[model samples]
Target: MEKFKSFLKRKDIEISAKRYLIDALGAMAQGLFCSLLIGTIINTFGTQFKIPFLTSPVAVIGGTEYTAGGIASAMSGPAMSIAIGYALKCPPLVLFSLTAAGFAANALGGAGGPLAVLFIAVISAELGKAVSKETRIDILVTPLVTVMAGILLSWLIAPPLGKAAMSVGSLIMWATELQPLLMGILVAVLTGMALTLPISSAAICAALGLTGLAGGAAVAGCCAQMVGFAVMSFKENKWGGLVSQGIGTSMLQMGNIIK
Candidate 1:
């Protein structure tokens, strides 16, 4: 065990919950924001507000036309994979190869693509990192290993993971509909706390494919957590704290909340 730990350390692989769950998960959220979320927002505006250029089809893939936003949204899988690889500090070849793995995971994972990408990307990046620069044929060896591992893993597990996540999300949404008062409070409180933690609540929601009542409750909880902290600390923190915690992030007030 000690020898293995030393090997990992020597290779720059730090095995810790903070590295995988916190740092990588946090980075995953940013990737989602830049790709899926922003694309959806732009598409929404284009559709609702009747913006001409925003709605204009820019490209086509697999016989389907895509607007600017659609192109970005379609790349969510690669974006998430590369983001996680970047967070893990995978080498250049390993990182670039993650795009393929990420695409496979996201495409195969279906609705739960984000979670699949998270799991697969972490494993692939680490595996690639372990083998990185170990051979004279580093360029060829690195990408081959990373891409194969990613695609195989994605094919084997991404769909099942996606289905499982979507099922869980369906259950939650169903339960919320059946018992609005109870489930609403339950989701709100848990999601609110999740928002303040180092974990990525957005990734959680995406993995579960949360929507309707459950989605609304989660959003409400997050907003309340952020705004509530800002309001509570208004006197002590002033506007600076308000903008930081409220608009910026409720995670900023996590230490204060714990205190």
Candidate 2:
């Protein structure tokens, strides 16, 4: 019990801060690299392997919802979680904060915007770290509090903000017939550039409004491929290999699915 008590204590603040920064930066960089690599591969494949069945699946599953911002948000969780846990020796608290931040950030991003959610996550993590002490109760308390706060923030604050952003995005895309397709390609490239972002295809589809055969099919294809790629790249997952397969299969399926 005494030994356990010792574990709950915070380390030197300077050391803790340094370690936190390094871990966060490393995670962010890795996510960014993956996003760019995936984007490049998708663009190349789109041109070379234009087959509907093949590309459609990739597009549907491997769409560009996962942006760098999303990745940075996710990556920040583990770093902040562990740092708080070790520095304060309150595992539960750290874990809770991580969970809260992740959920809040993702939900916010999915609803429309990510910037506000990201800010909330960072602030929550920092606050959790400050309040935690070397105790099991503290661990639990930290995360619960953070999550609750995030949930409240997301529901009351993020939703309205996201709706407004979506409205703008919708207005921007509504101006043209081929706008959705162009938007899809642009988003796909961005997702490729930021591999850590989540399913962006849904937003694109919603924006496109299922107005025509081509637009609907395109959106569907993007969603399938994005999802498929995410599934394949669970951890340090190879983007190139999965993308190749995704492109081939998604395009092939598009022809059958579209009609």
Name the best candidate (by TM-score): 1
Where does model 2 exceed 4 Å of error?
Answer: 1-92, 104-110, 113-117, 134-137, 164-168, 175-199, 211-259
Question: Residue-wise lDDT of candidate 1 within 99-121, one digit each (tens)?
Answer: 99989998888766777888999
TM-score of each: 0.75, 0.42
Cα lDDT for residue 98, model 2? 59
Per-model CA lDDT versus the true structure: 0.80, 0.44
- Stretches off by above 4 angstroms in model 1 are 1-3, 176-259
TM-score of 2: 0.42
Per-residue lDDT of 253 in model 1: 58
Local error of candidate 2 at 120, Å? 2.9
Give one digit per residue, the lDDT tens place, for model 2 in 83-124: 333433333555456555545554665534333344444445
